[model samples]
Target: MRYKGVRFCVFTLTVFKFVNGYLMTKSPPRYVDDYDNSVHSKGKFLCLFLGICSLSYHQVSTARPGLDLVYQWKQLEFDYQSEYDRQADIDMEIFIPGQPAPIDTDVYYAANSKESKVFVTIPRFQSGIPLTLGTVTDKMYKGNPVIAPYPSWSWHRSPKTCATERIVSVYRVMGQPVHSYEIPSRLLEPRSILVTPVIDIRDKQCEDTFVYIADCQTYSIIVHNAREGTFWKASDKTMYPYPNYGTFNIDGDSFDLMDGVLGMAVEPYSPGKDRRLFYHAMSSPTENFVYTSDLRNQSIFMHDPESSPHLFHVQDAVKEVMDGILPKKSRKIYEAQYDTFVKWCCQRKLENVNEDVLLVFFAEKSKTLSSSTLWAHYSMLKTMLNVKRNIDVSKFYKLSAFLKRKSEGYKPKKAKVLSLDQIDKFLLEAPDKDFLMVKTYRGERRTQSAAEAIDKNGVMYYGLMSDMKIACWNTKGEYGDRLYSDIVASDSVTLQFASGVKVVKNLKGAQELWIMTSRFQKVATDTLSSSETNFRIVAGKVDDLLFGTSCKGKKHITGGTAGGGYGLISTPRG
Candidate 1:
């Protein structure tokens, strides 16, 4: 008894009513449209067309539409402050099966609309494609469109203290509803629930269909035989929340809580399967999984409270892979910050590859800037090396270091630090009157000591900044008899104006002391004497300068607060 275009398969006789009872009668050609087209279109007509072709083959086979169901819970654009203005948008999209590429859908739960005042909470799906959705509705709006004699799932606005009610509905493409049920809130608590596929828990009296409901917040999974009117939490520590997995606010607790445990996924299987896995991910980066055998079996988990599932440290997995690619010694030289790189690798299914090409690729793809860019490259290389372990670990590590150092060592030219006399001479001599010349230039800006110290010989030493690195007078002017010139290097340098201006050899070199003499060189060394007006300035926090011991241990009166230097000066305690 076969039809004209019928091709029978193993999966048959499980056809629930077609969504909207819409069926295609005309026996069309078997592969008229491309298989890819049917996958994206929900193949609504295609599924119906296929249904006409064969009575069997109820389930529509979709392509590798990884995570076809996308459920997004977002707050709607409405006044949330007022108790009457409770509004939120829950978007649920199901990808059309057997599509060459994924496509978007107009289908959504119209909870947060002008018509309905129902606040949807805890949406969970059953197994298999075109599954039923169970959602809890807080209440109905006062001015809703529904007339009297209200529907089965319909309820009037109740007292504020009462909990919400649940609404279960089977939805198809384009938000078409096939069947719906309104379960009381008392039967199923609405928050953080994962509903498993219908299972037959038949004993002798009757065949009972049960579902495993897991509440992440309650730290419990309940065995619910809805048919037999029985529900109880499975006595297992495995169902509880991880010690660190809970809600925490980024901004201080002024706003509402961002609940954790995004949701859970149950592996699709026949009614009576013993071994199955239930996967759950908190709001954090990590995801964990537990076996259904332990979750379902009351005897094992109930008694042994210690039994819990293995927790997967996603970042650690990436680190382990990276460790295998680099040598033990090489690991200490580089910082293995490879979380983002590992995530990218995971998404691309890039694993067990050579180090050279991958390392170069990771460095080029990073968005880090300045010296951090080198670290980014190092991290990417480390992660990529771990991506594939086929390469020799020691050889790769050596090669990685070579490539990193070679690329990172290319330093850019440093900016020139002009002497105060040179800058001051340029400002005074430059033809461009607008260059570094404000209206109140002489009144506001003046030469100021940046660093100063008195040597044991009583020579007054000081470093002066005429202006704080203002760009003016592009051409190199004449280098006057400047007090000190700082040589720009790969790192910050310590310059001393003593004798001939010299750069200190080490980073932590002795504090620079400049011998402050008269503006003209007429004053002889023998007759030179420290002035009470000469203030000793010590480099303070970062660019700041502190006025230490005054010259001759007396107060050095200044025209301004340390003149043009922006650095804050500390009062000498002594």
Candidate 2:
């Protein structure tokens, strides 16, 4: 029975193979010898052998090694079969997976296995080209990893080197050599590049063109014209040098034919238009004057000096007072009156003292006072004049009046009582022949007194000589006896005499006595009171004292004997 079963199986397999071969042969050939012509022809032949085996075998094998081999062979066969089936269906219908079987025709084979299997169909005797299996693990083209030696033709060519400097290089496209005109190094280096060709419309020929290269680095704006052959650089133009002038530059706007201009003035007649230079001028520190260049008439027009009207006229009388030519008292009065006049004239405008007018007034008044006083007065005037015109005048008026009153009332103190040292020094320094008088304090009055004696102790004073009158003064400078006395004692006395013969009263008796005066002689005497008085030498000659008879002449005396004399009389023995 096993033998019979085996024979039957073999016969069944044979019959199936015959039927499959007949069907395959009867159908139009899907591919001819061209299908096996590829470098994978060995794989294709193996696939054909596997197809025959599948049809010839009656039982399916599931053993490990057998199943594996069968699986591989089946895979190969399926590939060839799919190719044939694809070609057969190409014209009539699409060979889609899971498609319904065609009615009355078995177009696709249904597998008995539960899992679906995939297959490929190829033709025979195709071109012997190597197929791309998949990506290889290794190399990198540019920065990207590539599967093959060559990528798609769409891949952009990358630059080898890039710099900021300008450079030129040649590139190859396919097998043709392309000449790259000079290109800034700033281009290239990027993954992608955009090239724009610039054409000059002015040129009829298309030869006037340029290539603009842009990359990721920076956008370079260049001017390129075929007429110019290649490219040209475009940048800002250089500035021109300005004109020079010595101490000051010429003011462009101020220039005029008549006026000398140091600066320019620009004026615009309308908006959005060029400015016009109308006047040329130089500024002055003194606002009264403005130097200008006049181009119109070629002559300068100076404003009048008297344009400012705050000026006050100083009266000549007042000027005289300030100049000190007028007496002190007169000057004081004049200044007061002048200040009053100024205050009245200035009124409201007085607040802004016309400086020029004030200056003129000052100059005129300056002639009156001392130079020092003039300066001080001028300074004060200037300060007062600096007050703004808007300021109230009442306050300044009151102040000026107050100042004038105070000045008029001011008085300096007088000195009293000359010191003893001062008197002595005056006497010592005075000529011996001259009558010198020293001032002295007597009661509440100051009186001039003469020095009677200058002893080693201190100065002595007596009557003062005034217009030939002898006014007696005591040591205390009190009014004392009018005539001389034979014996008197006091703290101090001053003496003066126009004539040497002067009468005196003897202290011993109430009787007139005469003392003889002598020139360059000294005498010491003692006498009885009545006898001396009775025999008093009424007009005895004396020198240097009570001797001269001439009122204004020098005195002289001769030696003579006197009655009852006590001290020796020393006279030159001639």
Candidate 3:
């Protein structure tokens, strides 16, 4: 079949077929020239034709390009600045919580160039009552609301809110409406209102509990107790009386008495407990002294006026004056003085009081500056007491000695001489230092000016010079010549050799020996040894060297002689 004015040719064969349409011309396969003998040749040909058709269709569809389309997602935004400007024009009525109605107010803009103002109108009630604005009290900022405590008014910041310049207002009518006039700065935003409850401690009976309040700026202490209150003024005189109590004289003027100042109360300790109320009263501009008041005995005692006119010590005397009264700065001074006095008394042994009292005083005083003064005072007192009592006072003397030693300067005791065996052990374990020197008798020497350890037993040292030279000594007991010439020597040799030593036992049955050494290293020597030859000096061989049966008599012997070669051999004579 053919259409669209095109002719169609169709041919059919058992092995091949062709169809020619109006769009294209078809060719028929010749069985003789193109047909394969394979069984699937016909199927392969059909498949190839179908693939070509499909490829052509796809190319034609893709080549026809129309309009392109793209899609993307975007967020929607509103003009916040425009909205803010619009809202700024509208007048919003402000009303406090738990109030009746909004009050008419005028909004004032901040000092910016923007002319911003809004007239807030309050609607009238149907009852025909005239509206009155609440009295504007004070302004607050941030969380702090300016609260006026007085009637006409002084303003204080509210403790709860963080706001600046809060206009605190009071209503003639109870619970009237409240409103803010305008928002000035960023800090003037109204958040919340706070009402502080009034408190009166005098109306309430608080037993046993004590209250203390201090003026941090003035360093004044106000103490209040349950029973009564006393106010110890910052001045010399103690004002306000409560109960019968003792009075302590401080610097002959300032008296410390028990009284509660402000709301705090001071409490007294139990009787017989050796409790005392002490005060460090600052008298005049620069004068300060300690006052003590005893609560148990109702007596006040001051420190010895002669010893310390500027300082006074009272023992348990402060307690009577300030017991049940809040302790103040004055009380502390008094207590300190009492402690000082007690320590002084005990240290001097003036009054036969219990030692525990002195111990307690010292222990308490140790917690203050008065402690150092008390220690010095006690030292002096102890010395004087010992002299008066005719006591040994060695312990006190030793303490003074230690303190004296420290004051002068600390000097290390001289190092003791080590035995040959000790020296060997030390050298074996000790590390080497550059300052140390080691020498051998074979004329080999190694010198380290700062050595940590040295072995000197194997070397025979002659005489030591400032330059660490080894010099030989002559029979005249003088340094004769340089021995071990040109050998590395140390400024300080640690070893020496003594030849031809003589030992003699004097009439006191004591042996005394005169040792003539060719060299002397250290000024003090506690041990002697020989490097070579082992020989012992028999005790009975030299009767003069032998002491009698009495060991005490041998100590008086002045001289002794013994013979040995190379090595040290100790022989005790009976």
| Candidate No. with top lDDT | 1
Sorted on lDDT, highest at the top, how do the candidates line up? 1, 3, 2
lDDT of each: 0.25, 0.20, 0.21
For each of the candidates, give the backbone clash count.
Answer: 9, 53, 87
Q: Which candidate should be chosen as best, given TM-score against the real structure?
A: 1
List model 2 lDDT by residue over 314-345, tens digit each: 21112212232334454344345445436544
TM-score of each model, in listed order: 0.25, 0.12, 0.13
* Candidate 3 residue lDDT tens string, 38-70: 111010000000000000000000011210111
Whole-model lDDT, candidate 1? 0.25
The full ranking of all candidates by TM-score, starting with the best, is 1, 3, 2
For model 1 the local lDDT of residue 91 reads: 17
Better candidate by TM-score, 2 or 3: 3
Model 2 residue runs over 4 Å out of place are 1-179, 186-197, 211-219, 227-229, 233-574
Off by over 4 Å in 1: 1-153, 159-208, 235-262, 270-275, 281-285, 301-574
